[model samples]
Target: MTRLWNAPDDFPDEMLAGFVAASGRWIRQVPGGVVRSTRDPRPTVSVVIGGGSGHYPAFGGLVGPGLAHGAAVGNPFSSPSARQVESVARAAHQGRGVLLSYGNYAGDVLHFSEAEAALRADGIDCRTVRVTDDIFSAPADRADQRRGIAGDFTVFRIAGAAAAAGLGLDAVESLASRANARTRSMGVAFSGCNLPGVDEPLFTVPDGRMAIGLGIHGEPGIAEVDLPTADGLAQLLVERLLADEEVPLPDGPSSARVVALLNGLGSVKYEELYVVYRRVAELLDVAGVVVADPHVGEYCTSFDMAGVSLTLLWLDDELERLWFTPADTPAFRTGSVRTSLPRPAAAASTERPDGPLPRASAESRQLAARIVTALDAGHAAIDAAAEELGRIDAVAGDGDHGVGMRRGTRAASHAAAAVAQRGAGASTTLNAAADAWSDKAGGTSGAIWGVILRAVGRELGDEADPTAEDLVRGLNRAVEGVTSYGKATVGDKTLVDALVPLADTFAAAVGAGADPALAWSKAAAAATRAAAATADLLPRMGRARTHGERSQGTPDPGAVSLAVLARVVEQSLSPVD
Candidate 1:
């Protein structure tokens, strides 16, 4: 439960509700999504925005002097009626015209499209700028068929700026179309959310897993992978969005600039949102995408849901300048958009050897392979454990640890497979795999897994010859990294519980002059034992803590997954027997 207020379940329609009474948070029941504006203005260039009610400032916040002239409020996931759309449009039009902006959804299409007709009939000059983001929803060519997730902000700024510039409705609408062409979005939901007045969610994508391209209203998605970390998740969304075989870079002064927005559906704090924003900005910088104007915090939302979405608007010379041209609205305040374009990442020179970091011997390769396979086998068990953990987390926390773990695992496995097939050096291979995991998988698990692989790789460096001692040292270092960054210990019911035991077992086996294969086997056994022992231990942190006693009987999902990883190493040791 968030420290917030909600309208009573049975409140009458059109009643001032949802907001705390007299808190001036501003609440009123408008039909469907068509909430009339309370602002004092017989405005010009009215901002008529709507979607489902939960998106917040998306449809409402952008309604102000430098933003929307008026807005139509809708029920959550439900579009305002044509009448409501036209009404808001009428309220916003000054003699010039109305600018219609909303996420791309079926209901929105029907309602807003209908509103266009109604406005034309009423002699109101109204135009629409639909935001079709969520690249994962469809192929880029087919994005029009997909529902908009978070790209509405870009459309708002572009078209809104044009309106602010006193451009005719035609030019403003054209700018919106260009923004729609350039913008893209994707989102992940670990758990489902409930609609206001409804006891249950409309749908669910499952617990401990993420539905890529998942609809804002709990609809199905492109794929279901376990959850990843904030940075990892940010990467997943960005990569999938830019996964066009290649994104054509704009020419400098020529190259394009970008405005980034990290939208928390709800429940996440602004502080955490900025953390994500910084990561995305860093990645964009790497891609040569300059940040012209970055907007964070909750511009759009899903009514207390725990997930977040990213929106990017690629800007050119014309669009970039218009971004900051003042417009009035309740949600967005105009700010400086003047900035330089980002340069492409520096290219590698031919001077140094850039071959695969360092290859491992056949024996070491076998060890790595077995560890990878074992991790794969435990996928089923990991899923079950994650689901249970998520349920527990939902009671108190955001209920996404399980999902994050699952996503990270899937990505890690895929990355490992690609690396092994390529005959890359051990450390280099691990780094590559970790990057893949962090990119495909999202959330905390991916982040931790990436850290673990990198730490181990750093120890291994480029090595053609290695002793058991060397391997043992690397394992120990990896464990240290996990423990250090994850801030968890053996009894915390995290993967460390199993990995810690594995590290100890590896050191003992290597000391006893055991074969690398046998050492890993022993490590696997120890990991399994430690993971099992977790069933009786209390979960002291993260989502597991929310269930209290309920979590006591289930093994930690993280621990089990770690055990699986150990087995993969053990299995890799066996010959083609």
Candidate 2:
């Protein structure tokens, strides 16, 4: 259990602060995470790695001279906002280029993709490599869908080593890619992890039982079984990994050379890991495979989860050579590095200015005021339902949905209030709200909502009071924006299910000459219905996809939240009784 926390939501920030203060010798504080306190004598490709914050020594702890150049830490079990990623990348980039690496997860993918585009737009020459090494997460044929576990160390180290060697962007990317492909990992959990200030663990396991093939984010394992002995557990893990044909053992098992890493998730103490690794090493030796730099300890974690994971990085001559390169970081270090380079100076300011407010007509300004009222009502609704949202999300996804939504709506309201105070139009107001919501929330829903609001804002220009036709066009744009970026369809059990019906019904009603208020009310009803009907859907996207059956009998938290916002907005549009 996480016993010492000032506030649940503030834990990530507090953790980062303490980390920087303690590890000042090797790292300096950055906006998102940390960077090396020292720089290389010459320019080199920057290898930026990140993910959710619960996993220590993985993301932030790995940022230093020869590992990650920087890390974009996110909310617990959530991806960093695109703004955070962009800031870290901008600060870390040298004259050469930047390479972003992280575990394969939906929120991480969405936000990282957005940051990559933004960086490229600024001509920063950015690239990404998502580590997918958990063999148990997906079938061999669908290895691309697998989750990244402790294998992250191998890929990050190889990429960092290549970059430190002054390799070009192409070579750095290739090395990371090859390392990822050559790596495979699997883990088992004896218990679930507790989120800060949360009473219950994300998921629970039966006493005296262990879950096999569990994910790092407290996701339930693929299978459950009675607890086994250390030697028995070692045998199970090694056999599964050895037989996983996804790992190309071209020279057969006996002649294969590999780097073995036995990682304790969190609560599993160092002594326990050594016992497990002892059997693991004995088994490998008997199998005649050469183990290179066999690492046994905590490399990644899940907020005090009682678990351990093993990763094997098959090595060729090049990989073996690269693996021996020196690194210096808060958590992991190898060979010595030049210490003459000075730490980077702190950023002057991270606050982005609100550009000049666009001019608006008197009627549009009044509408913007109303929009602010609607946002206030919506925010209130989310705040009220935050606990329920989290409950629904914990059924199949991480239980942070409610907390994330609450933060997003609060930020949105503040942004909208400020913009409306300046007499901005609907477009500017909504655009500002979108930015704030996404920036504060920093998750899959945050990214999707950002796209939705920005699309709507684009159609409702600052110059005029939006017509029914304009509203419909904006709805269409929002739907397209969400579906395109999120890659979720109507029945994917996401917000799109409610949003599509809401947009279609509203458009149809408007085309039939109903007023905007009536059309929106009817559309809100349709959305509510669609959202409720999602109780029977099996999620095909996002975190829930891995545990589709676990979500049955519950509406998607994203869909339900959207419906809630829609209903609140419609009520605000209606005439007061």
Candidate 3:
């Protein structure tokens, strides 16, 4: 259990504050995460790496002289927002292009991809390489679908080294991709972890049993078996890794050299890891695999999870040279690195001041007040259903959907209220809410909701009163944006399942001459039915796709939350008489 925290929601921010305070030599505080406190002698490709906050050394802890230049931290178990990623990358940029790297999780991909587009639009050279190295997450034939786990260390280190060596963006990206391709990792969990303020672990292992193929986000393992001895466990891990067809041994086993990392998940102690690594070392030696660098400690961790993972990075000549480069960070350090004078304090501010509001008609301004009320109702609905939604998500996905939705809706409501109070129109108010939701929530839900609101807002221009046709068109545009951005279809067991039905129904009802309130009521009901129907769907997208069987009896949290919000919005549209 996570026993220490002022508030569950504040844990990530608090943790980041303490980390920056203690590691002043290596990092300085940025709006989203941290950046190197010292400057390089010359401009080089900046390596910006990150993910959720719980995985320490992997992200923030690795920001320094020879690793990531900056890390965009996110809420616990959630990917950082696109704004956060862009801020960190901009802070770290030194004329040279920026290289973005992180684990290949769905939320991270969505947010980072958005950030990449935004940076490019601003004339900044930004590229990305997603590490997909966990062999157990997907079959060898579908290696690109694998999750990235402890192998993040190998990819980040190599990319950072290439940048430090003054490599161009092309070379740096190629090196990072090569590292990801050669790396393979597998983890097992003896127990699951608890998020701050959560009473129960995200998932539980039965007594005397251990879970295999576990994710770092407190996701339950794909399979369970009787716990084995240290030697037996080491043997099992080595055999699986050696047999990986996705990344074949570079040469015959006798001449292959690799970097072996025995990483401990949060609660597993160092001594126990050494005991496991001892057998792991002997097994690798007997298999004719020469260990180039043997690392045994916590590199990437799930917060307080009792588990361990083994990562092997098969090295070529160039990779081995980069692998041995000196590094100095808050957590991991190797050969001594020469330091330059500390960088002067950054003068640029990340804050963007709000501009004057656009002119709006009297009717549009009145509609903006109603929008705020609807948003308030939606927030209340999400907050009330958060715990149950989290429970449902934990069955297959990382159990942070409820927390994310609460954060997003609350931020959206606040932003809407503030904008409406400033005499903004419906379109301006919705745009403010959309930006706030995405910035604060910081995940797949956040990104999708942002797209939905922004698209709808664009259709509801400030110059005129929104009619039933305008509302229907707005909904249709939202659906189009979501589908284009998220690539989710009606049966993907995501929010799209409910959102598509709601938009289609609303459009049909309005086309039949129904009033806005009547159309909304009918649409909300259709969304509710669609959400319930997701219980029978096997998730074809996102984190839940890997554990589809576990979600067989539960509706997707995203779909359910959308339905809940739809119903609440309908109530705001037409009061009970």
Candidate 4:
């Protein structure tokens, strides 16, 4: 239902440009995202937050005095790359240290962790707090695995306030973690959201059914139910949130104190939210819970998703004080912020590394050329199957898999081709491709692919042509790298399902003295079979897990795409016509 946009790929950049232009007084544009235009007089711990682009006010809108010092924005429904996060953190740090915070997500975790390591290497102290507060996303025993949703506001606000008060990085991070523990949220969707340039919504609900325990990124909900009246829905939301043990108060329900946020996902009207909140307030009053600053509007949103979520932040003494701290931003302003003398701007750097390329044998350079050609064939395969992949993902996911794959492969092919043209070795070309793929794609799949390429690249040195054993070893390393980082196994209904089979079969074939190309062809066939077999399995990881049953009949897009790329790579190994 997101009708207003030019090119979908360009939307994020355009939106950021307009936001900066409109909020110039409060924020300024940086390479990755936005930072405060006015700096504090004294050095203070910087609070930086970020995520995908569609969740407005969540990230950029929260940047200003007494709030986030910077935000590292990414593509729609994608986490920012490590380079982007490092750039924003560097710009925001005032020398006291930096605290990075964001919703807990697979892609966000990988990229932010990388950025944290990079900052440490540069001698800047850094820490991270991943907000995991969506109670419905995981069981109580597995609360740490829950995805962060609208409750991100509570954690971010507490961290920002702590930092603004000149608290050290440790204190700020602790408070942020505490806030995340105290917050709980759940959501429902009447319909799915349409991404810019997409012709259809990510997923759909039956005409009279509603999706319960839905994620903000258009992920299919956990369950379906008959649509309830406004008051009935409000009761449902309040009842669930109140049941959480995090809500603090006297033993009696009526004496409980809480900070409440009733958020509209996107297309839901304010009037509709207010109507629901009316019943929600009545239920809270009946239960004896006292609500503070009960916000009712869009705090975090999915583009045109007809859904809403309720966040309850249980307040202890410290949390209450931080919650009431002064804040001024493009959206959501409260209390008053003290003005401080602006710090002087740092000088800009205008230099690039002037080093010679690493030595690469002519045979290795020839192999690099073949790698470029293989990437091109892979890119073409992804392009050909993009729409089908998107459709498959729509069964239970956000339906962005095809678009993301297209972007990543295109970037990888271009980077590899460029390096190969310059007589780079296979290792150098593959490494550059890995970085480009991760940077341009900006999602879970992208990060995994980056790991895959880099692992293979490291195994194949520039000095010599990769032997069959070397290639098989690299593939094994890639499988291990992906499994370790993504926490997914062969039966997890992820790309690992296909990747593991391919790697194992190829290695087995090589061990039996088969030719590399012949072994790859057989491995590709195994991957194809495994990918198809995923249609009968239920998803056990990622957003699709919420609607596991719904995804039973559809092959995982990630698995299928990987299989397709494997087939293309096999074809690339054949002699040219």
lDDT of the candidates, in the order given: 0.61, 0.87, 0.90, 0.86
lDDT tens digits by residue: candidate 2, 163-250:
9888999999999999999999999999888888778887788998998988888787878899999998999999998888777767
Ranking by lDDT: 3, 2, 4, 1
Please give each candidate's TM-score: 0.53, 0.97, 0.98, 0.95
User: lDDT at 400 for candidate 2?
Assistant: 83
Judged by whole-model lDDT over C-alpha atoms, candidate 4 comes out at 0.86
Q: List model 4 lDDT by residue over 255-306, tens digit each.
A: 6678889999998999999999999988988887789769999999998999
Q: After superposing candidate 3, which stretches have Cα over 4 Å from the reference?
A: 347-350, 574-577
- lDDT value for model 1: 0.61
Please name the candidate that would achieve the greatest TM-score relative to the true structure: 3
When summed lDDT is taken over every stretch of 10 residues in candidate 2, the lowest stretch is 343-352
TM-score of 4: 0.95
Higher-scoring candidate on TM-score, 3 or 4? 3
Cα RMSD (angstroms) for every candidate in the order listed = 21.8, 1.9, 1.6, 2.2
What local lDDT does model 1 show for residue 286? 81
Error at 493, model 3, angstroms: 0.9
Candidate 2: what lDDT?
0.87
